[model samples]
Target chain A: MAPRIDTPGAAAQAVDQIQQLRTRISRLQESTPPSMPLETHPALAGLVQLRAGAAYSVDSATLALALLAGPSRSGGWCAAVGVADFGAEAAAALGVDLGRTVLVPDPGDQWLEVTAALVDVAAVVLVRTTGRVAPQAAEKLAARLRKRGAALVAWGEWPRCEVRLTTREPSWRGVGQGDGHLSSRRLVVEAHRGSAPPRRGALWLPGEDQTYRPERAVPVAAPVEGVA
Target chain B: MVVWCPDWPVVAALADEGLPSHLPAAVFHANLVQSGNAAARSFGVRRGMRRRDAQSRCPELKVYRATPERDSRTFETVLAAVEEQHPGVAPLRPGLAALRSPRRVRGGETAAAALLAERLVELGVWDPRLGVADELFTAEQAARQASSQDCRVIAPGESVPFLRELPVESIDDAADGGDAVSLLRRLGLRTLGELADLPAAAVRDRFGPRVAWVHRVVGGAGAVPLSTRTPPPELARHVDFEPPLDNAETITFSARQTADRVVAGLAAQQLVCTEVRIDAYVEGSDDVVSSRHWLHPRWFTAADLVDRLHWQLQGGFKAGEVRAPVSRVLFTPVTVVPDAVHADGLWGGTDERVQRGIARVQGMLGHEAVVQPVLQGGRAPRERQALVPWGEKPTGLRPAAHPWPGSIPPPAPSRVLATPWPAEVVGTGGRPVSVDARGAVLGEPARFRPEPGDWMPVAAWAGPWPVEELWWEPGGRRVARFQVVGVDGRAWLMTWESPGTWWTEAAYD
Candidate 1:
């Protein structure tokens, strides 16, 4: 029984927040920790350092895909923000506990609820908004997410939430064992934070039978000893 | 007359299908609380049938008032008593029950049957019957005869005598007025035991060989074995708070403690609830104030459950007012599935991986808070979105980006600019912001500059897009908005010359 924070006319409420409102958020960043960058879990390290009382936003699907690749427990603690029901297919695909994942009904103040929910969830998968939010609502919600140690991710457009990740549709080529269907897909992604250069790699969806495998770092050319 | 349980497992499955709980005398339910009309229709009550429908189904079709608590209590008791006797009871329905036992024992099963009958009577069941048969099919039939406080024991070999006397109608009633009875009646078979009197060949010749089998069953002949099942776990305890708790705090505390106990029970088996239902009622308010607490699958913590109670009792819910002090509290796991997760493998597999993933969410969004829009039922696009429990998955993942062709186009701001700001849009670049005959205006306007902001010089912008909405009403399509981006690194979708001035449309995010 959460406090029923009815964001009455949240769209209208947030509409007032249009762009003038400013937001102050302390970010949770993934650092190398003076050790091996390879051994470091960037997503996890960054997640734990998140400030508890702030509000922020991120990409929902991207976060989920990243989580699927990284270490995580099941019971679907991750939440997708939207008014519609995301069933077993998506939950299973995301590899979270289907039971634990929640669907927030679409209330007018999607921004406000997204903001409010930010404080409670580790990550909020916002179905990228097609409609515009009141600038103030966006600021207040972002401010709140920053304080709450929660993260908001916009699924379609990353910058809208001020945070983002990039993953393109994977192309697969293979038939899966189940029902003789093709399950292979190939995907390429480049994840970047703030202004960091994107971490690039190829992802292979091994026909549903095998787990997703990411290719190792694409090497950057280092100038040879004598070469200018 | 199969009344749907509606306990998550039941209610969510009604897919524009026919109602199951209907037949008057048997269990009928359009919903858990009983759809008497649905029941009436089945009992010869047709469409447009009224109260007279009740009598048509079955005069004695006992309308057992349903309270989820009562159904649960009855189920618990039924399961308990069945387990107590044979140590093997598999639950069937909320208000109904079943138990399994082995057959063909060197020592006759009569002893087991007698023991079960005695226990059922002792456990507050009215009249109990003990049945001993090689087949479960016969055992169920034997129990049917034992319903009237009379101990009717149908031994394995003596089923002929036991079933021969019972009318075909009895078998139909026992099956909740389902199939077998009607099929048998159509074949002209009057009693269960009469099959024993018929010749196998003759029975088969008339009923396509299936009759021979029925004849054998009716004659109580053949060696049928039983498939025994394990009994359900028994974890019941009673507690009476000394001072009746009349306030929400007291009730919440009790609920919290109760939640601990519930969690402990599940944890012992390494399980967590996908759903937990909390039943709370005031001590003296038994007649009026009783509330049911529904938690989303994400509300797994003790705090979560307690918070749910606090929110409900302190206010007026659909169930009405919390008028009385709730003296008793019943916490049941409406659903407790298991959580079998493999540990993280070489690649940060399990929990660690999850934390990282969550961190990414929190890092960007700013916090760990997650919620969902819960309320639906709206006609407007903005009105349709409702915030619900965080961590919940979205039902419909609507495509996030779309080009509003007829209206102001994007590369628009992700945010809807605030309105009623008291502004003036003095320039429209000589393109009157009006809807044309073909509903098309040549590139509405390429740009604009705000009052407070510096004048926009460069024009790397697009659109004087025209939009008309709700054309039915006079002046319905109120604002003819446009998309304008200034060369000064700023972009906006502003409604030029509307009810008020310069209402900024959107930002590029």
Candidate 2:
């Protein structure tokens, strides 16, 4: 037995039911504290996408500052914990709003407590630990970050991070044997997420023009034999 | 009724310096004498005399800088004493105050004035004078004429004739700039009687409005009413322990109620305190053993106050541990503003939840541990940045707008070492490189070691950029700086001193 020809009214009613069911499925997906947009530097747009309620581990201080600059420029508060050697001017130059930034230079034995407190308020928190973090402490902080909808950028090793960024093959320009000053630097940034193959991108982590952007390919010189 | 204390500035300055009142003293503002004591006046040092001339007149004179704050602060006690007798007292200036004529008191006006004078004597006012009249101007004039610790009462309707005989200089007290008095004297009007005798229209046309007003007052035609002042409400709170508490936790627990009361008191007044001064007194001591002023980015809550008390008792960075058991603790609001000024916007302002969170961390660590970074003008990376304790307003920062010459061109270092690490830079043949007196590099730096062991050849290097800072001061520094990049591609800012020592100051990581 087969169904007869459908009327216009029945077709519209079917579309409405399908729409309602789709919305319900989306709501169910959102029950796990849906991820929100976290600003990432334009130079790293394709290389990485920072999401709220996630922890990202970084190898260098400059990388941490670069990640902090994104949210800070968009008018969000940021904090740094146990970063005794924080370079405030450099952060400012990278577009981080110093007015909205706070620092706990030395938390001593209370680093975890201090970082957790700051995480409750700031949109992004950068932490530099003196020693390896315990797995239990990291898990506890991860849950808090998820609950608060804040992102974490660890300057050192962090357990089970969403993404790990490390700088490699750094080459500085604008200096000679003893003449010019140290100016710009070009580095290969490798982004690793879970077990996925690591993505590599070349960037002028501040090019000679004092802007962070993807490095353009240098035109290869014509072969000597072909030119002759 | 008006009460006047003569040479109050000199008196207050001497008392503050713990100097003898009988000794000659003068308060100077802008190098000119603002006030002089009796002893200084006897030495020919008068008001408006240059500080040099006053010093020459009396070699042993105690000189003090004029501070209006000191004068007003010391005068607060006197005002309180006067208010005890008469509630609505008007303070005219640092040295003068007025109140409504207390004519129908237990005793007449004279008896009331005598009682006030007696109270002033206890507060160490050597010469306090009082006067009573129907109007404020006349009362002030009469007070100046009264003898030490005495009252001059002008009978009703006798203000005109009583004021007529006084010198034109009497009007100098009313004219803040003293221009009218000088003009009156230059015009040969010697006394209030002569000035009063002149036609009102002519005084207005030639001598100006101020002189005309003086003329009207002297003729008893214009009588200005006094504006009495209301007493300020008490906002300070204190808690005393039955048995002195040595444990910080117990002391904080005891002070919880007082902290709540302090916040509730401000809330009742429709105000919020932004700065509070906390004083902790130890057992068997009258003076405060630990005193600190705590500031808040926003208004303080009761819990915030209690946290501050605990941190103070637990020994903050500047305030070391409380030496003895705490007997009492006091909280005084240093700065407050209307609550309406800080009302949250319709869309809300900076997150209040964030403030609470940061404050929680401040409670965990000491207050100084949380800091806000600020940039200021300087040559070195470390000097260019300042770390202000969280919640404190940054003050006395060097202006960054001014072009600081000799500062390294931007692409600033990423990591500025909190403490410079000892490094070594060697030239060819592994000899330490040094800078000459003229800032010339004696030999080119070839190899460098940022830490103790590992040595790497320099990939690129520049400078011996010399800086001579505060050369005239005893704690001056004279050093040459260099930017060196190692083979590993990590750049470091290094300093070279005279003794062939190299130190790494920062890293361009």
Candidate 3:
């Protein structure tokens, strides 16, 4: 009394047809939040804040390490692309959970492609652009990064970045003559934005003993109670 | 009931090479013959024979290196074929498998076995054999006896008599871990009947528990229980194309559904796959075009599976290369773990979005591009941490708990210099500070100069802790470490290797 099973392969084909439809539907229904916000760094307080769908620039590796460490330690995924000279030890020292960090030491000619791919996965992507990027390519990558809700940490220059950190007058500490070690350095960091006077502050790039500590006012010795 | 494929390693190796089964083929492992086909065996090529000797016996024998993967993959296909008829077919090994005795057919056990042999033949297997008995041991013996027929059945009580005529060597290998058969032969017990006739307690005391097990098996007194396991449905999924499309996009697109189904199946069973074997087959052909085993950090998702396939198609797979892509794709989950143990912790582990993002990036870049940091025990800051690919369980590395003598004490350095920089330490008279062989400081270190900076006097300095490593070796090294604090409140861990040579190892924040 049952309808004749048409071609023996019909059942299999129908199963395949149903599966394709399901995949398409599931993909369409998938929607991710526009951005995954990261907590702002204390040192870069007023100047830099982490938000996906935008680009941020940093001048020093030490600041970049500090900026990345904050989010990464809180369980965000970070990636470094085409930054061949990145010091893994320095990143680790600054509290960047290297466990959550991905490094593409060299992306060669596929820097944009690599960055684009990284944007889809990593919450924060640090790209060291080697040369001038085509305006079209940059626009496309920026749009993709925005759509994916990933922040791009540009090592080199980037146009219209949400925040730009530039280090000036860097002074090394701890070392004297050629005998001691370079323990830390103090840098005056200037944050620049569109049509805004650059905000400047002084802090140890990596404070005394390889830490990112805000510059503290050294208590004046108070004339040492007549010791002189 | 047991169904066994004899010399399966040779069969599988030959099948992989597209060689005829009738050829005089013998597989070798480590220069010794492992399994030889009937054609090679007839020419005196035996198991464990040295290659040169086997070659002497059969000059025209085609030799092959052992490949366990091929054997396993082929046997898995055999198991799949058998599972179609008998659901709970438990694989004993690559060449041997057992199943629960089926309900009697119109022609009884022989007819049932004939049907099995017929099915194996249809799958291109020649001279397949089957045996049925109450237990696995006697059933295996029945299968061995059925070598000349399609099937053999040992009636319930006939197992003892059937086993009696056989040599004691027959039951020897299974029970005793060693060569119990040879020992029994040395003891003048040629037939299994003689071995079985011995008092059970005497056998147990003389030959240990294993021999006692053998006596029970042969005497038909003990039937070891069979662990009947059926392959889970989620273990495999396959899709076929009518016209055999060659386009990678189309093939992968079609495979997405199958992958999703496979993953969903595991999820339904509260399991997740850690490893999976993907197979691609050309239209109308049993020969696999490409096959690969992908390892995952966590359970595989549909997208992860699809990404791996696409990567492979785009030249990621080099060995057993997929020269032509047409027809069908099969995904087989090889390793799986329970889902209960894998659930993310509350507010601790990565969220689903994070997992997705990382996987996407890894897929785009390459598998090894993303790495996670793991703390490991070591003497120096540089050696204290290791980087492992994200998602993989960290293994095969030094444990962090081991107490490393001479390692820096608490208040671990905030950052470690990947490459140590050279520096110099001088005393008050501008004398380059040095440590003597007896661990005594040569000078009171005063001025510190790491580079071309102005000389800064050391405010406070710690001991010259000398350490001698690998002293028994010719390339031994001795270094004296010192901690110095500058007026700038910067601390540096400096090491003096020789009289005038100093290296700044790390800075303590």
Among the numbered candidates, top lDDT falls to: 2
Order the candidate numbers by DockQ, best to worst: 2, 3, 1
Candidate 3 C-alpha lDDT tens digits along A183-222: 5667788888767899777886566655566586433342
- Give the count of colliding residue pairs in each prediction: 127, 0, 16
In angstroms, how far off is B192's CA in candidate 2? 7.3
Which is better, 1 or 3, measured by DockQ?
A: 3
Sort the candidates on lDDT, descending order: 2, 3, 1
lDDT of 3: 0.75
Model 1 regions more than 4 Å off = A1-228, B1-81, B90-147, B154-156, B160-194, B197-202, B208-210, B218-220, B227-257, B278-280, B286-335, B342-396, B399-481, B495-505
Q: What is the per-residue lDDT of model 1 for residues A135-187, given as tens digits with 9 covering 90 to 100?
A: 67666665555444344444554334333445455333322211121234455
Q: What local lDDT does model 3 show for residue B294? A: 83
List the per-model TM-score of the A chain: 0.54, 0.80, 0.76
Tens-digit lDDT track for model 3 on B368-444? 66566567777666677666766565777677789887665543444455567888899988899998889888888
Model 1's CAPRI class is incorrect
Candidates 1 and 2 compared: the better one by TM-score is 2
In the range B1-509, model 2's lDDT, one tens digit per residue, is 99999899998898787777899999999999989998999999988999899999999999899998999998999999999989999999998999999988878999999999999998888789998998888998899899989999999999999999999988775435288788789889899999999999998897777778879999888877778888998999999997898888899999999999999999999999999999999888899888898887777889889988888888832355576778999999999999998888898576778778888888788777889999998988999999998877787899998887778877889899889999999999988898887878888889999867889999999886788788899978778889999989888899886657789998898
Model 2 docking grade: medium
